[model samples]
Target: MLEGIRVLACGARDAVRLCATLLERAGAAVERTASDSADYDVILVSSDFDDANVVARWKTSGSHMVCDITATGPQDSRAGRRWSDAQIQAMSGLMDTTGFAHGAPVRIGVPLTEISAALYAAAAIAAAVRVKRMRGIVQNIDVTLSGCAASALTTFLPAAFARRAVGRLGNRHPACAPWNAYRTRDGWILICTGTEEQWRKLKQEARVPQLDDARFASLAERVRHVDELDALVESWTTTLTTDDCTRICESIGVAAGPIVGVRDLADEPNFRMRHAQAARAMKAHGVDADTYRDVSIFETSALSDALPVAKRAVPCERGANAAPLAGVKVIEIGQYTTAPLVGKHLAALGAQVVKIEPPGGEAARAWSPGQGGTSYFFALNNTDKETIALDLKQESARAYLRTLLKDADVLVENLRPGALAKLGFTREALGAINPRLVYCSISGFGMTSAYPSRPAFDTVIQAMGGLMDLTRADGAPVKIGASGADILGGQAALFAILARLAAREENAGAFIEISMQDVAAWCALFAAGNNSARGQALACLDGHIWMEREVSDAERAQCSALPKAVAAVKLAGATPVMRVDELLQDGDFLADVLSAARDANGAFWPVLKAPYRLTKTPACVRAAPGAPQAVRLAPPAPARAPVPEDRPA
Candidate 1:
């Protein structure tokens, strides 16, 4: 979609190279140039690249420049200190939340922060391009690895705000029972179930009478007795092989998959199928897909009659009243993480996002409590949205959605592959309805999949996508503490939509499909290629610190004699590991990464600030939706006039 755009990637860091790779896969002409003699459409400068004069020249020449600040705030207490991804994760509480409850904080096995920052940077570049086209202004964007780390704490922050301890839970989910990797006869298989019905179904399928007891009845009760609950589940799983356990769970519609390592992606059916589809698509467009790096994740296509040229206009200053997407309208039919997170970002970028859920509300709304008894998981993903419950099974609701699509600029959903298409809202149907709507689908697998009926969750995707395999705790495969696959998939979906929207003047009615499994596989590339090792926790005089490199006896002795902060600072490559409670006490960290938003009952709670920082037409988060309001849907305009835009000051 970025056919003629020229991107100058000038750094040796993995994040910079990954960002350049993403842009190139999107059809940009990328060059690694350090000199500022020639101007380019986009410039990405990593924090390690110290060339102020060259960067300034590119900025003056009206290029869309992005500087990779390692963190949202100061990387360290020391002035002008730079941090690696491990150090940033240490300070940001990502490390502390992983690993076992009894063990020290351990780093995630992959380069998660670097991958996240690259995704954010690429999306920021696309957003800048869109703003330049719409308002004729150049942008200077700032992206931070810490911002990405902080965004992963969306659900954990609520407990932190309530003064509840947010610590490591190993592979177990804090809010759900039977949501960990259970040992099968041959290997381990991950099973994740959130609702009571799924738990009942699992119990019936496994013939575990103990699981049906009153002690394991309700969601809260099951969590309260998770130890026993897990023991009962394991008893049944250990009687069968890993494949048998997966088949049993899948047969009953419970989310389950095998825990694999990075080396297994080549043989994974879903991963191979996704890439095969990407290769076919690229070859049809007369491009050699194998030549492009990271083809699985960077599947950016307009999917229309012809590719449209991205618009270029005179570089003028943005008006004080202008927002990047002030006139944009979005329809989000999403449940948990991926698509709802995209809608939240679109709303933050000044789009009017109307979230359509089932009559009983989305699944996340019933998860865990955050502020004023509202589901914190739902609140974080649905901020700044206007919500309505529609029974889409009814013809009237589907007809109303059709009417809403006629004036909407974007439609995002993460339902099963053919759920919406089965309801007559296919891409062709959407194109005929508006002929200008950008339809984006974020699914566990692509719309065309080898296993169409398989149920997927974040844990399932992590297991199948190779992330869980690479992420180990105490020599056993463990899922990331946060929903890594969901987060990456959401960011990637946003990137595709923003990239397409940048050229929407001509490339209307685009279809963007994102697979969570494929996105996870792409993020695992760095770790898989390098055989990346996980960081370990080291004991200090006062507390423990984390280090990715092996510590010598002398270094360990030195750290043992000093406090965690002092040791981390004095050591060559150590970072202070901070828990959520410790970070909540940090004023600077809180101020830089979080903002207060009201919950459903008008009570304040913390939410992540926009991940990307743009100088011109910056993205902003308005207040979170407060209190339940009766929303009445209006019929479509008789003449199909354009949707009215709402601009907020």
Candidate 2:
């Protein structure tokens, strides 16, 4: 969305490279040096560059947007110090929750701290650009890897204030039963049953007599004896192939997929289909992987110029509502974290999002970690959004969905790729109803790909996208502690929506597509920050450590526990290594960090500060889910309206 903009960047090689590439792909002209330009658009200076003269010059260049990529921002107590991804991840408390609880807390195989910082930086710059053209505003954005890493764990931060501790989860979910990997004849498969019907279906389809017992009859009971439950499920799953088990479970309504490894993901029929398509597309464009190693992984389609217009033509979703997205109205028709998170973020920014659910509510509502039958996951993602229950099996439910979309400014969905088009919500139908709507679809693969109809989940993407092999010291690759692929994919969807919104005045109707596999591959670049990082456990003075290294050994120095080793390598640098709980034990640290206090129920909880902020139109959280009410949405405008014109720049 940044066409005609000039980006002058000075930073570490990796950070600067990614930033410059994104800017370039976004149609921004990027220059490596800080040469003065009459219309200098953005200046990104890294913490690695401490040259006072260069920074001062860039600051005075009349740039519309300036961002400082640091380990910790200037507001932080630890600002002004250089950082590797390790130190930031550790202090952020993200690394503390990585790996199994039995194993020492390990660093994420990806350089998420840095990657998130870059992406946040990109998003912040994009938002600032839109503001500048709209109102002639200038923004100084300071993004920190430590801050980004901390924000990525916002879903878990409530534990801090609830007087609860967030610990390493390993692979098993604390709240959900039958939500782990099981041994199969050839390999392992992941089987998750979120509802009573699915569990019963598993018992009936697989003919597992053990599940007929009273102790395993209920979701709560199964969770109480998850180990035994796993054993019972595995007893039957072990006799089948990963494909056979997944097929059977899926046939019976259970969400099941294989625990894919790097090889399996690459060789999987669907992945190969997409890969072949990518290769052909790249060849057609004359872009060779041999030419662009780091940048090649981004889908060829995603790298295309997103927003072609130079000026901000659309009106900013702002006014007395006091939220950046105040006038925005979104209708989300999908389940799981990927699609709902996009709406959740929009709702947080003050959009009236009407979430469509089935008669039984969305699948996540029953996924456990509930209080009095209310799903915490659902509450976190669906808060402040109106809910409309519809059973699509009935034509009336589909008709009502069209009513909700009549005036929706945006439509976000992740419904198994092509299923939406087939379910009477075709593009032509939506276009006829709301021609100005910005449609976004989050899928496991692209709509045109051969495997678009296949079922995909976070673990499968992690395995196929090469995170598993890159995540550990041992050859066995593992999925991230959190759903990295899902959230990043969701964030990608959100980012694209924001871009389309910026240009909505010109092309109000746009279709943005996101693939979880593509996002996973993009996140894998995090490991590029530390080629030597094996995700192995290391001993620290008071705790364990995981380090993200500098690419080549000759330049960047490494840390070591031994003083002699320090003398050899100049070692004792502040990398984020210690366990998060151990670090939180210090009362002084708790008092100092930037946090948001939420009064949920009768008690207050703490969540980390948002990674980025908008000075004029800030992100706002209105309320939490209270009592579930049945409400009908107001009918949308039947006639298509003209795109709104820009008010100011």
- For candidate 1, write residues 436-472 as lDDT tens digits: 6788988887887877889888888988887887777
RMSD of each: 8.1, 9.6
The candidate scoring highest on lDDT is 1
Off by over 4 Å in 1: 34-37, 60-64, 72-79, 208-218, 277-294, 298-321, 366-368, 531-534, 540-543, 552-563, 569-572, 598-603, 627-649
At residue 229, candidate 1 shows an lDDT of 91
Q: Mind giving the per-residue lDDT tens digits that candidate 2 earns over 467-546?
A: 66566524344567667777777777776676556442455466677777766655553343235334234544445544
lDDT of 2: 0.62
Would you estimate the TM-scores of all the predictions? Answer: 0.88, 0.77
Worst 10 residues of 1 by lDDT: 308-317
